[model samples]
Each structure stands twice: as structure tokens, then as C-alpha cells.
Target: MRPETGMSATGFPALVLFDLDGTLLDSAPDFVATIDVLRAQRGEAPIAADQLRPHVSRGARAMLAAAFPRLDQAAREALVPPFLAIYREQLARHGAPFEGVEALLAAIEGSGSRWGIVTNKPEALARALLPLLGWQARCAVLVGGDTLALRKPDPLPLLHAAQALGVAPGDCAYVGDDERDIIAARAAGMPSVVALWGYRPEHDDPATWQGDALVASAHALIDPAAWPRPR
Candidate 1:
């Protein structure tokens, strides 16, 4: 199951599934912009840029909650659609692949391997961001949160992506920054890699999560020579 020399994953991941927002792309700039819009609408003071960056990978609802924790439950629900709408307009406006991600995907593709996305973001937004990043045609598959009745941590979407890519669960690997990402991949019977570079709350510890491997940096994942091998 070893990948050929140039692939990102050392073992040929029959399908390499990635979590979009934090695993590959740095999406905080645009996410922060949307937060600013929400803040303005609520007549609230703006949040610090540094304060919001770490939560970008967590998703829109999380960012909203962080910015407006004082809002009641009904008000929180009311703010969601508008927050999402604002984010939609700016999905890829300032996003960029984290360092080495483009090269990693290139190495995988160059080695005749396939890669795709399995994200908790809704389908429409995920689809829209793909073209902006020029990955719409290059990616082998995309399974968003609402693509099916369930999302990550449930395993259905990951299973669907593997199926679509003609890969078996045993041969695939999922990479993400959060604990749920690890849980979803494991539940789907695939190995998981904890991406340490992604957003985490101050108190969170990615190492304690159950992942087959822990990638401390994006460049580390791109380097096949440094990968974990069988004992």
C-alpha cells in the first residue's frame, strides 16, 4: 500500500479525504470579515483579528457564537442565516492554501493518486469555494455537511466520498484539525491524521485525540520520506 515516490501520503491512500477550512486552506481572513459585518449589524464593537483567527476552522456558527455570546437562543438562531449569507459572498475572497498544501496535492496528483474534500461546510458553500480556489475540477470528490442527512462524526459523508472515489475505507485516510474529524474518520474505518496547525481553542489538545498519526505541520504531510511506516 505504499504510495509511489511523489505522493503526499506515504502509503497510497486510495482516497485522501481532507477537511476544507483548516486542513488545507487558511480561511480566517474572510471569516473575520463576515464577523465584522455581523458586528456592525448588531452595533457591537469589533472583535480583535487575532481573537477570531483560531475559530475559523470551527465554522460559521461558532464564529457567530464567539462574537455574540450575549445573544439569547432565539437571537442566535436569527443571526445565523444572515451571517451565512454574508460569508457566502466572501468565501474565498481572502483564503489561501496553508503552506505546502498546493505542493502536497500536486505531488499526490502527479503520482496518480486521488484526493478529495469531506467537510462540515454546507454543500453550496463548499462547491462555490472550490472554483474560487481553482480546485473544482481537480478534486475527485466533495461531500459537504448537508450533502446527505448526516455529516462528520457520523461517518456517512466520509463513506460516500470514499465510495465515489473508488476507494475502500481501509485504504483511505482523513486529515483534519478537530477532534470530530478524527472521530469521523475512525468511525468510517479509515485512519486519521490530526493536523496540528489548524484552529484549536486555547484549552484544546489535538495530541490526545485518537488519530492514527499527528501532522505537526503542513510540510510534514507533504514529505513522504518522513512518514510513519509499519512496525
Candidate 2:
């Protein structure tokens, strides 16, 4: 394989896996706009993007809950459709790859290494977003929350992504912003990195997630040394 570029391969891992919503794509802007549109339609005060940003990485349900904290389960479910519609319409408008993501992906791919995504987003919506972000052709594979019978923190989705990419779970590394992401990677026997750049509620801490590594920025991920080589 080609030597890993963009950074010194002091301890490069075999395969690199990614989280979509927060780690790869900065999706909060689009999500916030959708919330504003929905709230305005309902004659309610619009929520700010920063208020909803952290939950965007958590998935649509979380964003909906954040936007309508007083709503019951039934009302929350009802709001999903409209929120999704507006989100789709503005999907590419403000959302984009996080800083250095394109370069990181390119460097990884150019190094003769393979990378893919494992996200809690639904397959249809995630698939739609990828193309808009120009990642549809770059990522080797994408495992959405609905891709299998279960999602993150269950290990199954990560395992499925590794299997589909012809790599062992132990050979892959997962990078994300939440505890569930680290938990799933650990359960699947895959190494993980906690992405500090992604959205996290004020009460959360990436250090507490207990990932193999903690990345301070998106650019750091391109450094092969960030991933300890397998023994």
C-alpha cells in the first residue's frame, strides 16, 4: 500500500471509519433552518442554530425534541415529516464538509487506504445528504441507522460496514462525537477516536467517552499517527 500522506504515518491503523453527521458533515445549519421554518409555520418562536446544533448529530428525533421540548411523543412524531421535508429542501444550502474533511478523505484514499461511514441517520436521508455534500463517490460505504436490524451502540452496524468493505472489525477505526459511537466501536472490537470538533451539549465531554484517541479538530484525523498501529 502507498505510505499514508498528509501526515506522518508514525502509527497508522489499517482502515479508517467515520461518523457522518458531525464528524464529516457540518449539518447543523440546514437542520436549524428547517426548525425555524417549521416553528414559523406553527406560529412559534424560532430556535437558534447553536441551540439545535449539538442535537443534529444525534439525529432528527433529537433535533425535533430540542426544538419542541414540550411536545409529547405523538406530537414529536407528527412534526418529523414536515421537519424532514424542509430539511431535504435545504440539505445542501448551508451544510458542508467540516474543515479539512475533503483533504483528509483524499489523503486517506490516496494513501491506498479505505474509509467509510457509520452514522445513526436513516439510510434514505443520509444517502440524500451524501450526494449533496459531494461524498457519495468518495466514501467506500455508508451504514445508516436503518441499514441493519440495529444501529450504533449495538456493534452490528459497525460490523456490517467492516464486513461490507472486506475488512475485519479490528482493522477499522471509528471516529465520532458521542459516547454511543465509541460504545459501538468498542463492542465491535474496533478502535475509535472521539471527535471534539463535532457538536456536544455543554454538559458532555469527549474525554469521558473513553475512545482510543481524542481528536481536537477535523484536520488531526488526517494524521496517520492519530491512529495507533495494530500490534
Candidate 3:
């Protein structure tokens, strides 16, 4: 193994798992476009990207809540199918890796360490996005919200990913932009990193998340030295 490159001796914990939407990709644009599609039908102007940026990590339901505040819970719930349909069509149109993410990923791979995605996004959507992101062959494992009965904040998904990768939970590190990510990682007995440059808004303070480490930008992780070490 490449000790200088930081490859694990057992090739377990060989992966760095990440959250898809906010942690790796800048998906707020797609969410904004999707919301604008809904708003336009009612002759409403497009919502600002920032207006929906912070809600991206929470998935469709949260997007619906932010996009249609005037509508009550039931009305918002009813809009999910249509919202997902539009989002699927506009999936990667306005989304791309966050600045420096590509290089960061490359660095990880080049170091003989692999990476994967475990997201709250549906399995199909996450699977579809891999090809678009040119990561289909490179991603070591993918566990989506629907991959198992439970997702983040539950720890099942994270634990399941480690098992699939043949890595002990404590040997893996999870990076995410949501509190659920940290909670899940902590529960799974893995290290965690908070992506500060992700969809966090003024109200969402990542400080309290208590991840193993926190980064102000994806660029900060281009060097493996900046990555959080497994406990």
C-alpha cells in the first residue's frame, strides 16, 4: 500500500463518503429552476437562488415548503410528485461540482483512496446523476435515501455503506453539509467533516453540528492533509 499517500493498510476505510446535493454538487441551481417552473405556472417570478439554497439539503419537501410558504402542509405535500418530475428533467442542467470539488476528488483518487456517495436523494436519481457527473465507474458505493429503510439521522445508511465497502464504520469518514450527516456519522462511529461552503443559510449554524472537522470550502480539501482522519 501507499503509506505516503495515506492509503489504509487493509484497503478498508479506503473510501471517503460524501453527501451528494450540497456536499459534492452545487445543486441549488437545479432546485431554483424547479421552483421557478412551479412559480411560473402561477405567473410568479422566479425565486432567488439564495432563497432556496439552504433548503436544498433537506430534499424536495423542504424545497416545497420554502417555495410555497402560502400553501399549508397538505397543499405542499401534494406538490411533491410534480416537483420531482420537473427536477428530474432539469437535474443536471444547472448543477455541477462545487468549485474545486473535481480537483479534490481527483486528488483523493490519485492518492489510491476511493470515494463514494451516500445521499438522501432517491437511489434512481443518485444513480442517474453518477453518469452525468462522470463518476459511474469511479464511485465505490452508493447508498441513497431509498437504498434502505432508514437514511441519515438514523445511521443505517452510513453503516450499510461501510458494510458494502468492507470497511469498519470507525475507519470511514463522512462529509456532509447537514446536521443529520454529523449525527449519522457520529452514530455510525465514524469521523465526520462539515462542508461549510455548502447550502447552509444564516439560520443554519454548522458550528453546533460537532463534526470531527469543518472546512470553509471544498478547496480546503484538495490536499488530503486537510481531510479529517479516522478515529
Candidate 4:
């Protein structure tokens, strides 16, 4: 079903910021594949993709920890470079936007709202992947983890994105699949939505995150009613 479109009660958001991995994009497949490649090179059995999918959003270190639990912190850290190298070589090989994302983006644009991405992925990787997804020119602002001195859960990236869009934090909504996403949004004074469809650890509880709203799928987010509004 097509979402109802028009300015909301508080007016359309000046901007909508999204988390890339897990949120807007299903990138776990490529990440898991990269981990499996590493394991194969060591003559080790490949870890199940399902087992490593949840850690994809948490970044490479988390995936390495899951794939090689026996590895110490230093060992896991050492693997990051090679892991990312392999990941970069096959970044979008299996990555695709979640279902209904294109329609959701259309709805936002139809309302004259601008959208952008705010991700913890490295800037270069994020930039590289955007065009492959045909989103390079469409994104209003792109803020990666390394875009500033700090990343999510610190509010810098979100705030910076709002600033770049020339919108007040309160005039934007940030949607993400991780607790850090909500924390950063709340800290930046923006309404936040928890994307339940994104990568989430089995132990992680979205209920406890205190996000303004929760959406089960990209389709749900296309609805203006699903968006969090300033209180």
C-alpha cells in the first residue's frame, strides 16, 4: 500500500537521516561472506552467515569476535585491516537496500523532505557503496563514523548532519537499528525511530532503547504517522 503523503501536523521533516548498514541496507551478506573468506584462508570452517549477521551493524570487530571467539582483543584488532580489505573488494557484491526502501524514499521526497545517511561505516566505504546503490547523488548529506572526531552515541555525527542540511536537530528524524542510533538522536534533540527489521543481537531489546517509535519494516516507515514528532 502506498503511504499517505503530505506535510505532517508539525510540517514535513526538514530532513530524515538513516543508518546505512542494517537500517537502509542489508549489508550483512557481504560482511559475512568476507568473514567466511578469512576463515577459509586459515583452513578453518566458515562460520554460519546467520550467526554473524547480527554483528554486521556493530562493525568488523564484532564480526571478527563472533567468527573467531578464541581471538584476543589484539588479535581481533589485527584482523580488522585484512577483513575490511576483503570486504571492500566485495562490498556491494551481495548488499542491497531493505525491501520497501525505495518506496519509502519516494514518499519522503514526495513530501518535499530531504533524506541523508548517517552511518558508522567508514566514509570511504560508505561513499563507495552509495553509487553502487544509485544513491550517491540522492543523499543530501553523508556522515560516516570517521567524518568527525567522534561517531554515534556521541551525537556529533547526527548534529553535524543536521547542520549540513541547514536544519535544526528538532526538525529532523533519525532512523536506525542500533541503540547507539537512538542515543545519538536523543542527545542531538532529534526524534528517533528504532528500525526493528535491521540487524539486532538476540539479547538486545528495542523496548529498552527509549526510541520515540519503532518500525518493523521499511514499509512501516513510509507512513508519516510512523514518524516520531517533537513532544
- Measured by lDDT, the strongest candidate is 4
User: Which stretches of model 2 miss by more than 4 angstroms?
Assistant: 1-11
Clashes of each: 0, 0, 0, 0
Backbone clash pairs for candidate 3 read none
Q: What is the TM-score of each candidate against the true structure?
A: 0.91, 0.92, 0.93, 0.94
Model 2: per-residue lDDT, tens digit, 34-146?
89998898899879778898787777789899999999979999988888888888877987888988888887887777788889887888888877777778778888888
Q: Which stretches of candidate 3 lie over 4 Å from their true place?
A: 1-13
lDDT of 1 at 170: 70
Q: Is 2 or 3 the stronger prediction by TM-score?
A: 3
Candidate 4: tens digits of C-alpha lDDT, residues 1-231: 222233345355668999999999999889878998999988999788889998888998899999999989999899999998999988789978999999988888877888999999999999999889998888999999998999998999998988876777887899999999999999999999999999989999999999999889999877777887753
- Across 40-140, the per-residue lDDT of candidate 3 in tens digits comes to 98788999888898899999999889989999999999999999888899878998999999988887787677789999999998898888889999899
Compose the digit string of candidate 1's lDDT tens values, residues 34-146. Answer: 88888987787878878887777777767877888888777878888998999899887887888889988887777567899999999999899988899988999999999
> Could you give me the TM-score of model 3 versus the true structure?
0.93
Q: How does model 4 score by TM-score?
A: 0.94
User: lDDT (CA) for every model shown?
Assistant: 0.81, 0.81, 0.85, 0.88
Q: State which candidate has the highest TM-score.
A: 4
What root-mean-square deviation over C-alphas does model 3 reach? 3.2
lDDT of 2 at 155: 96
Give the Å shift of residue 215 in candidate 3.
0.6
* TM-score of candidate 2 relative to the true fold: 0.92
> Which has the higher lDDT value, candidate number 3 or candidate number 4?
4
